[model samples]
Target: MPVATPVFDLSHIYKLSPETEDLRVYEKGQIIIEEDNGKLFPPSMTPDMGIGTCLLNERPREWRCNRANVNGAVGAVVIAIQFYRHHNYIANELHELNPCWDDERLYYTARDINIAVFTQIYFYELLPILLGKENMIKHGIISDSDGFRDMYDEDVLPQMTDEYHYALRWFHVIQEADIKMYDNDGYYLNTIPMVNVSLRTGFLPHDENLEKMTQGSFRQYGGGFDHIIDNDVSNKTVSHRLNKIRIKYSCINLT
Candidate 1:
């Protein structure tokens, strides 16, 4: 089903409410991260929000972040973790540059920079690969030159249409099922079924899983943009059963 996309705000990072944001914050403008058996992991969700459906029976807590447990795929979780770390790293750097700045100033500044970094990656790096750079430039979706392009209109509210939301589902055709793991040295490690990692964030902190998965996220090839849909994506990932039913009904109506 099509859903509305809001403006390019990093709600996923800062969360929707002051209470949730407070829970994730550590002292000195850092997000709360825990050290478990010498490896760093996101702070554990208290009271168990029931999102970690695939988590091991022994592991009751999911990673504490606004959206980390939403899908809980290893790739998604790792990226969240990276941004959490990056935010703190930036906060620390800002403190060093301006020692007089208070925690609030440092935190907000770092958050702004983090959002900007994400925007840069989306526009300059990811979009060019997905939609040909030339096409994006031609459509004015992105600027062709390094100079600033003032396309913003105060009257126009940034909103994503239902059609645009539905169109994004096409990327599922390229969703990879097997998440390959590699070491920092680029040595191939074992592959994990992407299904196994869904909602099973507890798996990331153990046995160098986080580090290996981080390596693989950048190194592994995405599923080919071909006719075949990955079985795990079709059968196991969250919401697949409902999606299957939707597809079935749509086909029946069409036929």
Candidate 2:
């Protein structure tokens, strides 16, 4: 059977439909569930709100953020750490620039800029790799001509097609195991199960997990493109299996 072509570019990473309204970001400067410090925490597990209290022995206080628990499998954790670092970095710059600005102002301003930067990279950088830049330009999906082209069409609804949703899942084939950790000074540290790190942000600080993960990101290579998927992915072990079952149940309810 031939698959239907997707009518929309993949924008669901940032935009959510009415059915996924809960995933929408309500705050201007923050991501959907990330805290001011850029660390994500579960709704049920909040650390003391006092200054420096969010950290346990210099590590991010741990809790179960459902997103982290279910779908965070290594790649997601890396992305989360990337964004968290970027957010804090930008916040620091903003704080230095506007000395009079309060914490909330600094946080939100940094978040807004971070999101804009992410969006720009997503379109200009990632889209080119996924869909060739020439092809995107030819299809009017993107413009080759630079400055300020507003291609916004009010007639087209901002909803993703079923084909688009299904197509996005193909990236799973490239996911790798064996997440490596390294220190800031380029020393080899230890490795952990990417799945094990999920829902345990606190551990990112323990034994220098966060610092090493951040450093190792630039130093390591992702799972190679090959004929076989990892056995863990193929088998859907433990927590992953439960996540799949829940997704299956949700799909059944939808149907």
Candidate 3:
């Protein structure tokens, strides 16, 4: 059965329930701080930063937004920062359009639009690669002729299967440990161990780490499509063990 895209909703990004959402708000109307224009991440005032320490030093949290999952990997944090900036940008733009809109309204409107775009990208752009554009079109997942078409189905509730998270684990095979930083002009700056920067926002402030990490986004590549997994992810990260456990317990049950 065909289901609506889950990414369009702000389901996972922010808690829909009033209880959890209330806790996320920092100021009366404003939510937690998300950096604007790829600037320095908000200071780590608490363990929510998920700052982890290593031989070099104790890394501090850079982003002060809702989630601080250190295990999400370095690339995940970088992507989050970009999305965070996007959300803030949209919020400011909405604020300009409707001066009467409170901070909460602006924030949520921005978040909704951001999630919508994110959903479009995944469904239209990313999914085509694996699911095939022709297949998607045939199945009516996407339109054959594009304008505006409503495919919204109210009956289907948003949910995920145990296999969903397990499937995302494939990224771990290609996940790189050392990320190379660069400048706007493509100048090589330095390399940092991704583990060192996890949960530590302070690493972004001391130098050009923030800018450099942003620049690295274009230059860096995940591991190749080869069947092999990086040693760090397999051994040090224990992603392999996790995968085995999931396969043994969860996937088998599904079958």
Candidate 4:
């Protein structure tokens, strides 16, 4: 039942898989983002690229990235796009601050800053909120002090374990079926099924959905941590996939 552990394996999520390196990066430090009538979107995945599964209709709108569209939902996709934009934003700011800095320096520095920002948010913001700040601090998952702490070990290999992978799936219990939308004025607009947006990045740009969803992300309340699991989440193909993973991990000889 202990959710926090000292083991760290970023290779599964942090490191960009080899195949996606070319597709993700453009010139300089920015990730590739598509523009449609002045609006930015994730780069489109090529048809039958065979990286990850996507619906036939979604093939044209699918996002291309390190992990492709594997387990990609609207919320996850939105986060990715935000980071993509953040990277470009940082790169531009760095270029402005240091006019002499070349593309390589700009890219690497911006990338590092962008990654650090993500880590800060993940450890100091998200995890603290979810797992409790005091708990995170006690477990050594985060530090109370703002000062830098060096804990890196060259001997430790970066690899994820089956237990950690399986434990993360517990989050599905809090997955909301409805993705609520709101306007900048704090007015509720409407909601679309979270499942409907899966693998369907095309839907984001249509009718200012992206902007609304971005607003809704913070405004809308996530599913309560109660007995109720969203029907869509419980009955959908995603559930089936999770079940498969459960069975696979269950069968593993922990001994």
Tell me, by lDDT, which candidate is best: 1
lDDT of each: 0.64, 0.51, 0.55, 0.62
lDDT of 3 at 5: 26
Query: Model 2 clash pairs?
Result: 204-210
TM-score, cand. 1 vs. native = 0.78
- Model 3: per-residue lDDT, tens digit, 39-157? 53422335654323211223233333334222233455566555555666677677678888776777667777888787777778888886799999999888776566667677867
lDDT value, candidate 4, whole model: 0.62
User: Candidate 3 — worst ten consecutive residues by lDDT sum?
Assistant: 244-253
What is every candidate's alpha-carbon RMSD to the true fold?
5.1, 8.2, 6.2, 5.7
Which is the winner by TM-score between candidate 1 and candidate 4?
1
Ordered from best to worst lDDT, the candidate numbers read 1, 4, 3, 2
Residues 79-191, model 4: lDDT tens digits:
76677677788888887888888777887788677767777777787878789999988988788888786555678654556676665665666777888989999899998
Which model, 1 or 3, shows the larger TM-score? 1
**TM-score computed on alpha carbons, candidate 4:** 0.77
lDDT of 2 at 119: 60
Residue pairs whose backbone atoms clash in candidate 1? none
